[model samples]
Target: MRSVSIPDAVRCKVAAEPRVDAPHHPITLSFTDGVLTMEGELADLAAKKLALERAASVPGVDHIVDRLRVAPARTMGDAEIRDHVRDLLLEEPVLQPLARATPSLEPGVPLRPDVVLGTIGLSVARGVVTLDGIVPSLAHKRLAGALAWWVPGVRDVVNGLEVVPPEEDDDGEISDAVRLVLEKDPLVDASQLGVSTRRAVVTLSGVVRCGVERRAAERDAWCVFGVDGVTNHIEVRE
Candidate 1:
């Protein structure tokens, strides 16, 4: 008897994830051999990551083709997005050394890259930003991806930044990205916001003038690349 039990099992596991199956999310799953293809719009970045994690946990699911998406902040051309990402990477004080190794946006050539750790190769095609290179730490890798995602026009981020020392990725990286997200958004006052992440779950606290600001702060938290969950603790004073 021909069997198709693996896909069924994977489906069950995926459905079991509340966030994946949430009313706001529309996910479509397909399986072929050991590869699972997940495509659709999740409520936010956390939901998208959680959905992929859920599908990969299934026994026979060896490779996952993630086509998940979150509602984009805005839309722009590839060139503009690439420039924004490049500028952010260069402007970040912590990432300055790594950014020096990044290729220049004008002619798509490396400008004295290979300075500190290794070179960062960047490209944007159809709103997807691909970053491939080596960084000194896992935090640097995550920070670069978060910056790419921070761009309003970026639809997806392919973070291939290898940590040379192979440090373990932890909650600290998530908190750092969350803090950067808050700081980048003009509507939210980062000083008034308390940012924290534990095991990939983000907790946004503090008070804002209106419910809109509060919601914006929470949404900012969800926009980071590696976030798994967001708990909004923001209060609206007005």
Candidate 2:
């Protein structure tokens, strides 16, 4: 297929999204073979996600390669920031219940102390937050990571929480779940895309009209119960 030159209207469309902070960082957009690449820095993850969403909404954009970085406006000492994050975790409504669960220990059976979401551990160095331990579900893990990022001085978050659900689904089940989600999502047309899974990794391929559908498909796949990774290979045919 011959690649179309990126339209100036598309570039204008992306640049016109509402800015998140006072001094907006520029996002450089480039196109090749219908894939639009967004590169540069933004104030935070929210802004980055918004930028990508805007890019996807453009009429002819197919796939988007996001290489945006998040840079916080201010910095705080590691100790103070760590304390703040710890308090946030302790106070989070969803995590409070999990935090209150008692650790179980049985004699002659090794105690897996790190098996609960409440046992999340946090450490900070040079503004980076490292979260480690176990969570009951992927939602809890994401909550911990989001809390870390929400802290004032956090530069980056390393979420190492392990999800140990009571039962695990096989690859086929995971694939089916992702496909169903894509089919149901208003933003994505599943008939125009392909979904496959192996070892919990999902690969989305085929063609879509714009970037939003492509990203919406990937986001839905990631939200599935057992998806560990998503490899989106869908092409934009617009």
Candidate 3:
């Protein structure tokens, strides 16, 4: 019989995951009252989820406080990040229906306006993007968060966008968004990808021709809101 400390067990799990790149981004784990807190910087959103998944699977671990951050995709100033995020939201075709119309605002055209609380509002300070507003459905909220994550040079995203007349969220909703995003991604072949979700944890399976496609599928899953964990089992074969 072997008794491994909780911290050691978690460490081994994270280190064994090649996607985590544990040596570059060291995760500091602290266990207290059955809650595990992971604090550190990770290379990407995929790595952050992978590390959290590892910690959650460890025996005796109950909850996790994700203090992990993904290194910004690029380096830019506060103003630049804010503008990029705003432009992205305005550019999304699916979100056009939610775009509020104003005096002198043309129909069927999404415009970039100042931060409006009730509608889509945007702000950035110190590389963190804060989205404040109301969306119609859970899919919209998740889509908004994913778009913010796509912006270059964003360290973190605070998804404060509230769902108006709240609707129920289920694994089906998450799966729908996952598939939609993957379909929209030019780098990914969604036709060959299988997506499923349980308890907000998404599992991606099926086959792709290259590692880049496999990684793209995983990233799309991570971008979806309500996704607590992502298991990328998509095999790469040429």
- Maximum-lDDT candidate: 3
List lDDT for all candidates, in order. Answer: 0.75, 0.67, 0.82
lDDT per residue, candidate 1, 130-196, as tens digits? 8887888766776778778778887778888888988766788788768876776778888888888
Model 1: colliding residue pairs: 101-113
How do the residues 153-225 of candidate 3 rate in per-residue lDDT, one tens digit apiece? Answer: 9887888888998988899999999998888778898999899999888999999999988987888889887
lDDT of 3: 0.82
For all predictions, the C-alpha RMSD in Å is 4.5, 13.4, 4.7
What's the CA error at residue 171 for candidate 2, in Å?
Answer: 23
Stretches of model 1 off by over 4 angstroms after superposition: 1-26, 41-47, 57-62, 101-118
18-90: candidate 2 lDDT, tens digit per residue: 6534246776778887888876767765556556666777777889876665675466877677667766776
Q: Clash totals for all models, in order?
A: 1, 1, 0
TM-score of candidate 1 versus the correct structure, residues matched by position: 0.75
Per-model TM-score, in order, reads 0.75, 0.42, 0.76
Error of 3 at 137 (Å): 0.6
